[model samples]
Target: MRPDDLHRYITERMRMSHVYQPVMLRELLKSDGEATVEQIAKALLSHDRSQVEYYEIRTKNMVGKVLTNNGVAAPVKDGNRIVGYRLTGFGDVDAEVRDRLIAECEEKIADYIERRGGNIWQHRFNAKGYVPGSVRYAVFKRAKYRCELCGASAEDVALHVDHIIPRNRGGQDDLSNFQALCITCNTNKRDQDDADFRGVADSYGHREAGCIFCEVPADRVIAENELCYAIRDGFPVTPLHTLVIPKRHVSDYFDLFQPELNAIRRMLDELRSSIQDEEPNVSGFNVGVNAGASAGQTIFHCHLHLIPRRDGDVPNPRGGVRGVIPAKQSY
Candidate 1:
């Protein structure tokens, strides 16, 4: 379009969902009517004050704390807001010395980036790499544009779509496997919680060659996720009874990790819905786990029973699982 048309559209007719249209156009205009996606993205990022606020918090709480503790620099705060930082001894030094120190700092940053390469940003990109914009929008929408972990509004803090079970720990890319967290909460969870997922990913592959659950045939798996699977019980306690099992060979439920529990829970909910759909008479479910042989756990490998309960399945079902102990079934 001509300049008059473009200007008219921008001034009068441009309907905006966000600042993106103007920002992208500005970038393209600055580059002679052409700009890379990266350039547009960087320009858009400059308008994101939430990300800037996140880094400001990091500067004040982490880097500033360290520098101040070591007597190297201090924060320049406007009331409670930290606007910038000042080097401790730089003001007293000669101009040449100050320039030399600044150069040294630049050299340190360059050397670290050269040594670490892109690994320095691994935490941001994570093992799953870039999440598509649509998927990120879905996650944020699911969270109602709030942090799932801390309930921080998207307007107040930068929110991230995080894996409920980290991909490095064998977490999958299922919609059920993601959560929304604000920048502050996400950083604390990843850094301060000792997120040492080094061997956890590989550990999900552990299996005993002879274990029934571990060696369960592919045909038997009715449903599966990254860390667990479900199958029809060979010996059904109820018509549509099922077994939710961890892929890893662990002795019992007590040995399962948080991610394993999450996977199992997802499988249980899915199977429950499927069973109810298939069997209209199914009134409820009995979820049980026998942890040891003494507790009637003969399989050894960790598995949970998802028994579909129908009305009148038994003469006295009021006691439910209390039937585990015959005498205690009454109350």
Candidate 2:
């Protein structure tokens, strides 16, 4: 195409879902109509405000606080946000002295990188080096484009495909091994991969022969995590009713562990998303747990009911879970 054709296409015919097309074109133009994929990607990364926001949080909460407390530097705040840092006594230095100081900083960075080697970036890159884009999309989809760790939406922050178990600790590159985590949660969890979870793993093995949920067949399980499995209710109150049960035979909901609770919540969210996709009319859900005999618990094993609700499913759906009592359902 000639210059006029290119100009016409850019100004008139360019349809943009994001800023990517123009950014890539600008990069190519800057590089004399050619640029490596890496160069273009780096150029794109420069425009990602979320990444800068992620580092801003790190500066304010972690490194900046440390420096400020040590009397080495202070935070430059733009309202409540830490926009940058100002070094102590640095403003007093001339251009030459500042250059020497910058060189000293560079030397320190180089020495640290040399000493640590690739281990410095071990938190970001695992044994496999990178997760396939398809696998990442699947993980993100399963998590409903929200961080599984902190429940942050993808629009609110940058999400990462993180290993539930770190690769250094023998985590696999399987679909089931990956989870969607926001940048903040991922960074907070990075160095804490060494936390011992052997006892938690062992707890999932606790089961009683008589408990129906404890012995739920593999065939019945629709979705599961390490601590919980979800199955379609045998006698459903609604069409897409689900039972999210803990692996361990814990009779009381109060007796369930935190990890087990997290697993159950994740399974519930996954099932809800599936139901919504499969049944477009699904407007809401009813989550219930019958604790003891008085609360109408039939099985000894703890199981949560996830019942999908639709418009006009009931004559009047004013008080949802309160409908269990029937009398107080109206008010």
Candidate 3:
């Protein structure tokens, strides 16, 4: 066949295979000279049977015959049975054919992205790394060595400087973006990827100039003077829950100093007391804070959740932020 005809046939066959275009092209180039259909399939599909079947049909149609070594088709030996086929010297030539196929595929992909009005790099942002010492010092100063959420003092409490808006969401490596979080709250909101809650720190002036928390008729809030702010727990395993937040907006427990930590502790005490008085049958509490989306902090503003727990809350409350969170594990 003419090289142009072979290229076109190879391209059409590859399109029908449903293999990942870029990955297949890379494998073809990487082989340097030759590769088996079995080797190619193993590289592409790994253990996926659907993928193997798709490639098998495509390869047969394109190449006219199964690849072989010494007149025997390469086959996966499962006990005494031949389960799969391998490629031959002819298959190596086919790899070159696949390369031309990929160029066409890339053009199609580029056209698709252009039609959709998507910039290739529009999603990427500046990812400036943080200075650890500065971050630690900033946390200590922000919280005044207190737990911002629970108001635990630094004397016995562990503190962390948490990002109010997580780093993943274009949060800058600056002091204002950090908050003092306690061990409990820090563990809760660790590396959270949620963008809605963790709005860009610089974009706050543009987006949240109006406070969504309270209905005060003010353009800007001088202070959010309440100890415990109410927030929703999106993936609640428990029913009837709310979070407590400090009046001041801070990210983590470590961001709070002595006074702020004291305030948080006082708030928790009051909440616990109130719950005991109002709901006498209240069995326990599932208090938490998420630092980042990965850790499960959905909101950027500093807050503590007071989740009411009853018997049989969940079969396994051992997953999510609760399971692997590195808090005071005893509590």
Using TM-score, give the best candidate's number.
Answer: 2
TM-score of each: 0.64, 0.65, 0.30
The CA lDDT at 189 in model 3 is: 55
- Candidate 1: Cα lDDT at 173: 80
The prediction achieving the highest lDDT against the true structure is 1
TM-score of 3: 0.30
**What 10-residue stretch in candidate 3 is worst by lDDT?**
322-331
The C-alpha local distance difference test score for the whole of candidate 3 amounts to 0.54
lDDT of 2 by residue, 44-124 (tens): 989887777677667777888899999999888899866788888766778898799899999999999999998887744
- What lDDT score belongs to each candidate, Candidate 1 first? 0.79, 0.78, 0.54
User: What would the per-residue lDDT of candidate 1 be over residues 226-273, giving only the tens digit for each residue?
Assistant: 889988877676786788889988987998976687678778988999
Model 2: runs farther than 4 Å from truth? Answer: 78-81, 126-139, 147-152, 162-179, 188-202, 207-225, 228-244, 254-289, 304-331
The regions of model 3 sitting more than 4 angstroms off are: 1-211, 214-239, 317-331
- lDDT, candidate 3, residue 260? 45
Clash list (residue pairs), candidate 2: none
Candidate 3 lDDT score at position 10: 67
TM-score between candidate 2 and the true structure: 0.65
